[model samples]
Every structure is written in C-alpha cells, then in structure tokens.
Target: MMNDEVIKLIENRRSIRSFEERPLDPEVLDKLKRLTLRCPTGGRFSVIEIVDQSKKDKLCALCENQVMISRAPGVWLFLSDMERFYSWMKEKKCAENFGESLNKPGIGTFHLGMQDAIIAAQNAVIAAEAMGMHSCFVGDIIENYEEIQAMFNLPKYAVPACLLIFGYAKSIPTSPLTSRPEPEYVFMKDGYKHQSVDECEKMYEKNTVSFRERGVLPFDNTGSYIEWYYRKKYTSDWMAEMSRSVGVFLDRWLSDEA
Candidate 1:
C-alpha cells in the first residue's frame, strides 16, 4: 500500500553512531541548515552547529563523553529559545506592559519552544538521511543541564532540547532493521487501549528477542525485558540526572522570582 520514495526513506533510516571523518559538502550543509529552519514552529527556537574541534570536544564531555559527538564531523544542538523574543520585547519597551510576568516564560511557552526545537531537529535528521548522510539523536545533552547551559552561555529561557550528530555513514548496516511492535499493538482504532500484562508481554515479544540476539539485553536475562529496561533506562542514574536537570530548567523558566 505504501511504495514511494518517502516510505522507502523512512523504512531505511537507522540510528548510525559511527561516521566518516570527512566534512559534509558545503552546499549540502547549507541546505541542511536552511531546511531545518523551514520546519513548523509554534515560536522561535535556535540551532547551534558545532564543527570546531574544540567545541565538539567540550560538547562531547557535556554529553557524558559520548565519543560519537566528537567523531560525527557535525553536532547540532537544537534549543527551545525564548531569549531572543524576550530581548526583542524589552528592546521594544513592551516589557512594562506585561511587567514582571514577562520575565517568566511559564510552562506553556516552554512546551511550545520544546516542540519547535524537537520538530526542527527531526526535520534536519530526515533531510540529512535523504542527502546520503546518517544521523543519530543523542538525548543525553539534557543530562548535564547546568553545565550545558553554562557551556553555551544560554539564558534561563533557552534550554537544550536535542543534540543531533550527523555525517556520512561509515558503512551500511548488513543486519535486518530492528523489530517493532505490531501495528495493532501500536495503533488504536478509536480510543486508547491499555494492554494487560500478558498483552504487553506479547507486544514486546519481538523486541525482546531482537534485543537478546543483538546482545543489547542483560547477559543473565534474570527478569522480564520490561523490568530490565525499566531499571537500565527509566530508573538509571543517567535518567535520574536528566529528570533533575529538566526540573531545574523548568523551575528557572517558570520562576517569576528569577
């Protein structure tokens, strides 16, 4: 039912961690930047493309020393940025109209900005894949929240939403594409359906098998994949830090006293 260029592109896309050392063609890079900016947005956001070795090194450290950050030849940080808008409002002398309330962006603004940034980042990733470049989304940039903000000298209203690393693929993957939940398990005909434990297990059966084959699951496989994944990801120290950092960013963005 779906046989088209877009469908083929979507089907072939994969998370590529390794990349070639060569730089992207200048024209391609420029087009990518333009395409990212053309994405739908609720409000203004920002992009910081890191090509400099020094900055990439710093970003690598901030993203928990992910070597891929430094090796990818390009690292793009998409940010939920209200700083420019706020500054513009102040420069236009409209800050007094909203008074102190203008200083606080509130949760709504934050949510909008986050959506804008993430959507734009996804656009860039897809565009890169079409242009024959592979990309990986590193969400760990939010883990070192304060340090990342300091590294970029970002204001309270400007928060990092995603980090994208892209370059020419080192090699095409020989293995089959990763498995996913069946269509029935993922899509709903009308309303949401909360699956029972057995249904959930059945849904994850393929994923569990694939992970085990790929050596992604624990060696011992003591408990169910759900429990293993929950402890490894949801309750891991990295996730804890990410949650804490997001909380701090949210507090700063919504704090009228700040």
Candidate 2:
C-alpha cells in the first residue's frame, strides 16, 4: 500500500490553472529544495531555477505566447547540464568537443542529466501539493528551445526540461481520474516489441471519449491526435523555425569539439 503522506499527496495533486493571491510559505519553499535535491539524478547533477510572476509572464510570451502560463505565479525550470561537469574536471577536462565528450559520462551522462532534471522537477511539484498547494507542468517552455537558451542566457550545456508552476488552488474538475491501459499492456516483463502505427491508433481510439469528457478536444485516433498536435504546435512558423535552428546549432556545436 502507498504510504499515508504519499497517498494524500497523490489525491491532492491537481493541475490548477487559476490561483489564490497568496505566495507559498517560506517553510514550504525550503521543503521543496530539500526534496528536489534527493530526486534521482541518473547519476548527474543539475541546476534548477524557480521563476516568479514577472519572469514567468515574459517567458510564456517568448516561448509560446500562451496567456494561461503567463498568468501563473510560481514556476520552476529544470535544466540539463554538461558544462558543470567540465568545470569540476577543471582544465583537465578532455574531449574538447561536445560529441567527443559523449563517453566522459560513460555514454549515458546526457540521458542521466535529462532524467535527473525531470525527476527533480516532479518532486518539487508533488511536494508542493502535499503542503496544500496546486501545480501544473508546462512543456511549452521548450517549444522555442533556442529562444529559451537565449532568454535564460544559457551557455553551452544546459537544456530546459519543463516548467513546474505552483500556487494555492482555486477550482479543479470533479471528473474521474484518468485510467491507464492495463498494467500488463503497459509494463513489459522483458524485451521490448514494437507495435505498428495502425495498432497504436486502435489503442488511442479507445481513449478519445474519455479525453473529450475531460475537455480534451476530440482525438478519435492517433492520426487525429497527430492532426491536432500538428495544428497547434507545428503550424506556427516561428516555432518551427526556432526548432530547426536550434537543432542545427546544437549539431554544429557538437561537431566543433570532441
């Protein structure tokens, strides 16, 4: 059985859009810092920044122009980093080029940094909820990733994972908690066997009715999910341009060193 504190937190963790005027208690803020520090790092350390209303509004505008996010009062940005390791290694750091340094962390450092950053972000959110606060995870912060790098003045090695918003709760839906596919279906006992695209669509189709009831626009199938996602996220020229440019920049950056 889940622990009492964990169960209560899980039940209370609601994704809130609106908020009360109160800022979080300083004691609660301290707790989040401690909890996040214990989050699994995939063996690599990361830096996290908690954002305020002014910065959050600016970031929301810059990232996606989404007014909803611009209105949130508390937010945390999880960033993946490799430069910090290089700093610790001091001048002794070898593999001067990015691509060449892939082996430095034993071939999995990059993934570890990402995984660690995300887990830490989740910890902050869950802990915030346990203290009677509400939160939401905003993935839009990276939609314009290059802009994100520039906006934060990020140097060579940090990538933002997500934005975790916090505040006192206002209203939340009374809808049934969303269901997952059978545990057996989602949990693999051994090696992975990939499913076909058509078969994948079948599984998605079964979830569309529930999604609609939850105010999710109709996604009758995976293709429909694709259509809606593309329309909302990919159609923006600025978003696409930034995405392509960032990929090119990172590739060139990686190409420059070992």
Candidate 3:
C-alpha cells in the first residue's frame, strides 16, 4: 500500500517549463543528487550538471530554442555510459571476450542503458518536486548528437540519454489535470494484443477532444484526431530531423566496424 503523501506527490506532478530566475540552493541540489544516486541502474550512468551560461545558451539553441532550458537554474544531462566499465575492464586485464562484449553495444544494451538513465532522471525529478522545485524533461537532447558529443568530449560508448531542467516555477499550476487513457488500453493481462482501428480511436478520444478544444489542429476538417496528430507530429520536419540524428548516433556510437 502507498502512503497518502506519496500518492499526492504523484498526482500533483506536472511538467513545469516556466521557472523563476533565482538559482537553487546548494543544499537542495546536493539532496537531489543523493536521491538520484539511489535510483537503480543496469550497470552505471553519468550525470552532468550545466551551470555555465554559455553552455546553457548553446543547449537552448541546440534544443529547438526552448528558452525554458536557459531560464532554469539547474540543468542535468544524463548519459548512458559504458566507457567507465570498459576502462575498468582494461585496468583489470579482463578477458578479450569480456571487453569485446560491449565494444559495440547492440539494441538490447542500448535499451538497458537508456532505461537506467531514465530511471535516474525520474528520481531527480521527483526529488526536485519534493523540495518544492519543478522540472521538465527535454527529449530534444537526441538532436545535434555530434555537437553534444564534441561539446562533452564523450567517449565512443557514452551517449546522451536525456536532459532535465529544474528550478522554482514562476507560478503555481492553475490548469486542470491532464487526462490519460484507461489502463485497459495499454496494460495487457497476458500476451500482447493488437488493438483494432476503432478500438484505438475510442481509447484516444479523450486526448483528441482535449486537443480539439485547445485548437491545436491546423484545420477543423483534418480527418480524425489521430490523423491530425500524426500529420502534426509524425510527419513534421523536426521529427524527420530527430530520426536522422538517431540514425547517425547509432552509427557513430554502436558501429561494430568502429
């Protein structure tokens, strides 16, 4: 059973983008770091803090000019790091087979690292929220992969997993809570089951209605809500660019020939 405080914290959590200008207290930051360290990981990961104004500015540019990144007092870059393990293997004179195991991490390894990093990031977010701070996850870190690698001087086996910006929000949230689809739509009791088109539409109706109310659809005539979402998101130029970046990142970081 979960405690009331914990349930309330989960229910109240929101993605905060607007932040106050003041910096976070060092003690609070330290506590957040400690909390993040407690998160479980497959092996290990690295967390880099960005406090420099110039780097924050560059990051803002790299991440689609999302000014909230620059505004946040604390910016954390989570990385999936296999380089540290590789170094340990080298130092200990580990077998060549063991060393070669991660020479070029495949999809399975990539997923493990990504999951580890994400769990840590979430821990950091919850910690910040607990301390009366707010945070937003910036998935755009996937873009400009080469520049990020060069900027951080990352080793071949280390890759950016996500970005988290934390600070005090400019104001308390006044908007209504966002709706999520029912568990049956996503959670399966047994084997995977494919949802029919109509079933999918029914499941997504609430979100689609919300989007329509927000006037997000370009034109009112844009077929179904799902179609409008697909056109706006899946077929967008930014999505294409992000896809290209992912391909390039995989080639550079996980190429067996390298």
lDDT (Cα atoms) of all candidates against the true structure: 0.85, 0.65, 0.84
lDDT of 3 by residue, 1-258 (tens): 768887799889999999999888898888999988888867657888999999999999999999998888989999887778767876776756565442444566666778898899999988888888889999889888888888888777778899999899998789987777889999987889999999998998887787878777656754567888789778987788788887887787667654
User: Quick one: best TM-score, which candidate?
Assistant: 3
Score candidate 2 by lDDT. Answer: 0.65
TM-score of each: 0.91, 0.76, 0.92
lDDT by residue for model 1 (125-242), tens: 8889888888999989998788888878888889999999999999989988877788998898789998899998899988777666666666575446787688788989888889
Candidate 3: where is the Cα deviation over 4 Å? 96-107, 218-222, 256-258
For candidate 3, the 10 contiguous residues with the lowest summed lDDT are 97-106
Candidate 2, RMSD to the unseen true structure: 4.7
Write candidate 2's Cα lDDT for 176-209 as tens digits. 6555555545666688868776655555654655
The lowest-lDDT stretch of 10 consecutive residues in candidate 2 is: 98-107
TM-score of 2: 0.76
- Name the better of 1 and 3 by TM-score: 3
Given candidate 2, what's the lDDT at residue 151?
70
Better of 2 and 3 by lDDT: 3
